[model samples]
Target: MALTNSKPKIAIVYASATGHTERLTEMIVDASVSQGLQPEIFPVKEFDLKELLRYDIVVVGTYTWMNGEIPRQLHSLFEAIEQQSGDLVTGVFGTGDRCFATYCGAVDLFRDMLHAKTQLAATLKVEQMPSAEDRLRCDAFMNSVWRKYSQHVENLVAAKP
Candidate 1:
């Protein structure tokens, strides 16, 4: 959906296996609100697939499953978003254990697909949990989302006759 000069609608949706992804979601939410953009939050189970197009930007959070895999809970959501995808600005974040051969593999997976299917803005991956240092990355992630949204609005304006 193309956003007008009004604040662009954004949704932060996630599937947290053991709460790590949820914590990261909270961080992103806090930072976004602090920056004056109120994003709606949805646990993957609670989010309605039909409502995907209501927002101009969609942020996804996930926890990597064993040996580099997208958690089963997120597979449908992934496909649903992809099926309806376009230039919907997207941001992906994930959490995982360092011992895994592919740490944050789900984030990488979503990142790759979103880069192709949507207007991928930024991506972030955290170890099991976030630290104070990770807050900087979270802030940067939000900045990237906003920056991309701004660019999209500019393009829309430029395309006008």
Candidate 2:
């Protein structure tokens, strides 16, 4: 559903093959709540491109595959967000094995395009599932997003008169 509210909407959309990315998504969701921001979590397959207009912030998570290709399920969302989310703040995160040459390469792929398209608040790369040490990074990512959203709102208000 399209959102129309004073509360800034955030969506954590992701693709997870082995559940590692999902674990990261949960951390992001919890972080958003702790920031006093309600967020919607969607699998990349279930996300609607048009729903992007409803959000002020968008976070994407993925697991890197062999080399660094974006998962097939996320390719379309990857392209669509750049086209639609220019005014929105965005963050990208992923989980991957550091043993690989391109650790969390999928995060890099998304990060490049998001920087070109959205406000690209923060990008995080976590090796596999998040551990206690990663909690600080997750909180920082969420804080960055909240700061961008707040600044955007302030700018809007200032511009109005």
The C-alpha TM-scores of every prediction are 0.95, 0.91
Q: Please estimate how well model 2 matches the true structure, expressed as its whole-model Cα lDDT.
A: 0.85
Estimate, for each residue in 78-159, the C-alpha lDDT of model 2 and write its tens digit: 8778787467889999999989998888999999998898888999999877897887889999999888777766766666
The C-alpha lDDT values of all candidates are: 0.89, 0.85
Q: What does the lDDT come to for candidate 1? A: 0.89
- What TM value does model 1 have? 0.95
Model 2 alpha-carbon drift over 4 Å, by segment:
1-5
- Summed over model 2, clashes come to 0
Q: Write the per-residue lDDT of candidate 1 for residues 1-161, one digit (tens) a residue.
A: 65476798999999997788899999999879876798999999999988988889899999999888999988988998787657688999989988989999999999999998988999999999888799889999999999988898888788888
- The parts of candidate 1 lying over 4 Å away from their true place are none
RMSD in angstroms between candidate 2 and the native structure over all alpha carbons: 2.5
